[model samples]
Target: MIGRRGFLKFFGSSIVGLMTLGGYAFGYEPVVRLSIARYQLTPPGWTPGLKLRIVALADFHACTPWMTADRIASICARANDLGGDIIVLLGDYTSGTDFVTGHVDHRVWAAELAALKAPLGVHAIVGNHDWWHDATAQKRGAGPTFSHKALADVGIPVYSNRSARLEKDGYGFWLAGVEDQLALRRSVRWKRQFTTGLDDLSGTLAQVNDVAPVILLAHEPDIFPTVPSRVSLTLSGHTHGGQVRVFGWSPYLPSRYGDRYVYGHIVEENRHIIVSGGLGCSVAPVRVGVPPEIVVIDLG
Candidate 1:
């Protein structure tokens, strides 16, 4: 029943008030066109003179608008700006929305992502969200094609407890990626087993030879507790760094160890873990203190 003038005044005031409360306003925008952050990782046996810059992108629950093709294109454009030696995409690529053949249509956004060229290429790992979306549902034969293959089809190799070697500036390091713990939880818990070909933390670690500095790609930070000493640095993305965190605290965390494993760089003995906030929203579309992120890690 409100007139146009009255409605305008009320809605405008509400938006302004929300902004004051740390929420985005009607015209709200990020100061940094893209939220770019940096971290330095010093791992033992790290390739000397490596100076490798890695851009880590994660938790992209590709559900159209939120992680639209355009957004992904923007991400690629930005990563190219950094000129990182390698690009690492730590999983959670799809969300609740079902896909065709258990995977998002790679054709929709793959080219843009592939546009991001790195000497070592782009690597990925599955996340809890990926498992929930990829595996067969209770009543369904197969949900959709939302698995790692989606990325692989576009030339991005999604590693599940696998090792890939990358060399930069004549120095090389081992890039190890693992599957989500939740995906392997069944075997780990009841069967005391593992999904065939899935990443076995111990087995994957054994492949690296411990001679080269290893940078592990683990989608969930909780895997940190289980990682072997062979890993010198681990990059993960499941926490989204508490996607909606406030003052460095999240309402809940799924880390097997605890929330302390939620964000930033952590040093456990000789292993260093860096948890990226990621580039897409999951579960909820809104992001508060935890802005979507693109992390640039320099390994020297």
Candidate 2:
């Protein structure tokens, strides 16, 4: 048995250690670590030695203490400096929590994001948070627009269950974007709530030619399994790399597939998915091992 003094000393040391770690996770980690993840993708039909650079930015969740409008602007500026041929914006531009409603002026965000420079142009897709925040109020009567006007107002085309062909230097590929899978909430009550919307994968694919390579933009990685093998790559950001990873594992990953598609590159049966750690946090304003990131994918 341990003496009283010894037990007290041990308990005190443990408390101090936990506090220090908490401070690091909630403070320094969220603001300091912005990583650039590089990947090489060789989609089907690509000519040998030919490559394309795609930069992906996701989940800004702006207006928070760590991810303010100024921080968002800075992040965009940094992405521009990366010299990517195409830039893809995966959604969740605002935070959502009881304390913070995850609201940001779309017009103002558009101005800052418009500064992004990409040779192939910038394209975007909507996330669940955008739908929750009702970012598509202008087109609500018509259908779910998901920040379409806001992004388009600044020259960024928003794709919802649609596909677009991008060609450059005699090479081209098909890009498709789908609506948020979790956006069709009919009620605010937790137990009564259910999703009514479903992503139209077939509708989006119908616009693309089968001969060319295809890339997809989806807010949630849970849609990966349903994606056809014809899609060369899929980019997503909803998990936020579990927000806080302990020993390289996250317990709070919000996905049907759990940590299988949490973050970084995941390859399954020749199809690829890259889930960005993202630029902001939701629910909780802290990040542990999984720092925010801007993904830079080089395809050859």
In candidate 2, position 117 carries an lDDT of 90
Q: Which digits, one per residue and each the tens of the lDDT, describe model 2 over residues 1-300?
A: 989999999999999999999888877777667889888878655646557899999988776566767778889999999999999999987665544534567777777889999989999997887777673432242344436677888889888899998876777788899988877556554332566555788889889875678899999999899998888889999999999998988869889888899999999987889999998887888889888899999988
**CA error at residue 12 for candidate 2, angstroms:** 3.3
Q: Model 1, 171: alpha-carbon shift in Å?
A: 2.1
Give TM-scores for every candidate, taking all chains together and pairing residue i with residue i. Answer: 0.80, 0.90
Using TM-score as the measure, the top candidate is 2
Error of 1 at 8 (Å): 18
